[model samples]
Target: MNAPITACYPDPGTARPLTGLYLDHALPDRGRHGPFIYANYIASLDGRISVPADTGGQGVPESIANARDWRLFQELAGQADLLLSSGRYLRDLEAGTAQDSLPIGIDDAFSDIRAWRVRHGLAPQPDVAVLSAGLDFAVPRRLLDQGRRVIVITGESVPDSRVQAHERAGTEVIVLPNVARPGGAALVTALQALAYRRIYTVAGPFVLHTLLSANLLDSLFLTTVHRLIGGQPFASLCEGDLLAETGDFQLASMHLDAHGPGGCTQTFSRYDRTPGP
Candidate 1:
């Protein structure tokens, strides 16, 4: 049981091509509100997005991170106007624990995406917006060398000195008037004002939970690898206590690839937010 992906849910016919599956989506046009926000995640059958790594940091289990999923992941990143991330990622980079770079379309594997960005009149790499209330990480020098516009978003309680530090590095720092946590509406309003129409969040689950809680997420792309990973100290796609009202998403598309690591299979699905004001 090993073959390329085939469309299943809405329509079924020829084996759909794997590449450009996500890239074909007109993400920027669907933003009637602030921005069309989306996130990409690959999980195991048991819903494990990450497990304990040998280096003490959590990592995506290799068995669940097959190459096909990675291709779609890159495609998602390739279409973003800005990538929503966290300051903790910079801390991890300094600690030599970070997994991947913040920039997309740089490596030869996806160099074509950079060209595609140019063709579509977008920058080589999407700008990066780091969400943090602590404001305690140094922007890596290599990121600047790659020419990514790094914007820092922090709460009002943060010290002015911290904001200036990032500004001094030519990194624009946005200090929102949020104390406990920047709820979904405030954050999206700020992003929308900047004219960022396509927001792709690659940050951890906390950010996704924040967006979903506010019903601000527009799309969710998930790849479920047909494998079970059960272990202590693992993480899932969304985390936190049960929400007052769980978010609802209607499936937009689904595809099945009969090949995964060790003869397993994978299901790639996309869900759109139910229409609401």
Candidate 2:
């Protein structure tokens, strides 16, 4: 395990600010394959996603680090018209409970993320989509209450009662026969069909691994705090060497903070997956 690197982010007092740069950084030129989607994340120098102590959860950071992370999160969260995540992330980050519903204040907090999008003339409330092996009624009900459209993707057949519950609360429940793995492409198709562009996928390693392995990622944003921690590399985006093939790849431009509390924001050069050789 690598040790945590000591880093610092802007103190929110900088006058020039990052808003415009962020807006420009997020919206890439569109392509026929689809609108550009960016994957946003933060990690320790060693590439760990969560805290290592198993303090019954991912690692914890000091207030400054936490603030910087949330700042990055809010910025990216504001840019996305649709926020997608695996059921596991929701469970770990939001619920931490087996029941389907989120806590009462959850909707309002999400509303703030939504408001940022609206200020930029993006969607008022992004369609919050979750993929799971089974139904979790808590999510749809909680998210819908916040005026966000909640979408539940499940592999198992959804019971009518759950469907009715979602509809009553103004959420959408989608059922798919095959959702065990590699379901992200299908989920993207489904969301596109529902008119959701500018999708953002955030989650733990497994879902991240699935999408990368499927070659579905278009952009990757990382906040590299100059710290070392213990964790594994995220799964590679492809099965084999893809850079050497013809018509196979493109450049990804990245912007790093000229200074930091040892923290830097890195955005991946966006591109489509080239066909396999």
Candidate 3:
């Protein structure tokens, strides 16, 4: 995939093909409420999604990482079924200082996005949850040997012996009742009561500012790596109290992926969360 691309919002230059461009888009229920929630990132141009990495922590700032924005971040994690992540990315994946969780179907340059998730049935690698309210971390046995389904979501003040040590290591902890922290409509109504239609956070920016300060994100998919590096304890995209009024959004599409790094230019936006103001 050499990234043949174009487009400039709604539709302009046309000629697209960033590998199936985020797989059609499966959202409805008004905002895909049943589970069409979405999120994706890769910033810079002053937004700095991360920086200061010498392995002590923080990453993704190699002057706006490249490879055509990781092939649209593995085609948006190959159209997720469930991949919202956090808890400091499982403590930086046991402190090896992890990065690149956008690993789907084990990448052979995304094997045609894992055969488009087996011709659209999905689930050859998506099920991951995680979000942590400090239950601490450690769930990376290569994501349970790729069978997936490691879940863990958190809240309700944790510590029932850390939720029975992640349900005795079978891991499936979800605890968000009465809140102690777990917003964004209680984490998509608890993954829409565990049915998880198409939710996909792949966590960062404090869970995209808790689903855009709780209007419950419909779609985002940013990329913007036009280049810029100011360095100063960075990490952006959203990380606390400010966006409200449903954090309005609107650009339903846009692109420019002239490939990044030295080649520069990599816009790739996709907004869509503005039903009101």
After the best TM-score superposition of candidate 2, give how far the Cα of residue 111 lies from its true spot, in angstroms: 13
Worst-scoring 10-residue span by lDDT in model 2: 1-10
Q: Write the per-residue lDDT of candidate 1 for residues 1-277, one digit (tens) a residue.
A: 1246888777965587787788765566456477788998999999999888788878778778887888888889888878998877778877888878777856687876777788778888888888888788888888777788888887777888988888988788877765546556677678777788688999877778877877778889999999998966768888877876687889999998887788898899999888776
Candidate 3 residue lDDT tens string, 1-277: 5567899877788877777676665444235566777787889888988887887677778778777777777777777777888888788877777776535847476687778788878878888887788778768777777788888888898779988877787788988888787776787688778886777787888878877766678878789887788887867878776675647778988878786778887788888777652
Please provide, for model 2 over 95-175, each residue's C-alpha lDDT reduced to its tens digit, 9 standing for 90 to 100.
453222322113454454555566667755466777666455355345666677677776545566766675676666787
Model 1 spans with C-alpha error above 4 angstroms: 1-3
Each candidate's number of clashing pairs is 0, 17, 0
Spell out the clash pairs found in candidate 1: none
User: Measured by C-alpha RMSD in angstroms, how accurate is candidate 3?
Assistant: 17.9
Report the number of the highest-TM-score candidate: 1
Which rank order by lDDT, best down to worst? Answer: 1, 3, 2
Q: Give residue 64's lDDT in candidate 2 (0 to 100).
A: 18
TM-score of model 3 (CA atoms) = 0.34
Model 3, runs deviating above 4 Å: 1-13, 18-74, 78-82, 85-103, 106-127, 131-143, 147-151, 157-162, 170-181, 184-210, 214-244, 252-269, 272-277
Please give the range of 10 consecutive residues that has the lowest summed lDDT in model 1: 24-33
| Model 2, runs deviating above 4 Å | 1-19, 29-32, 52-55, 59-66, 93-116, 140-142, 157-170, 179-185, 231-251, 258-277
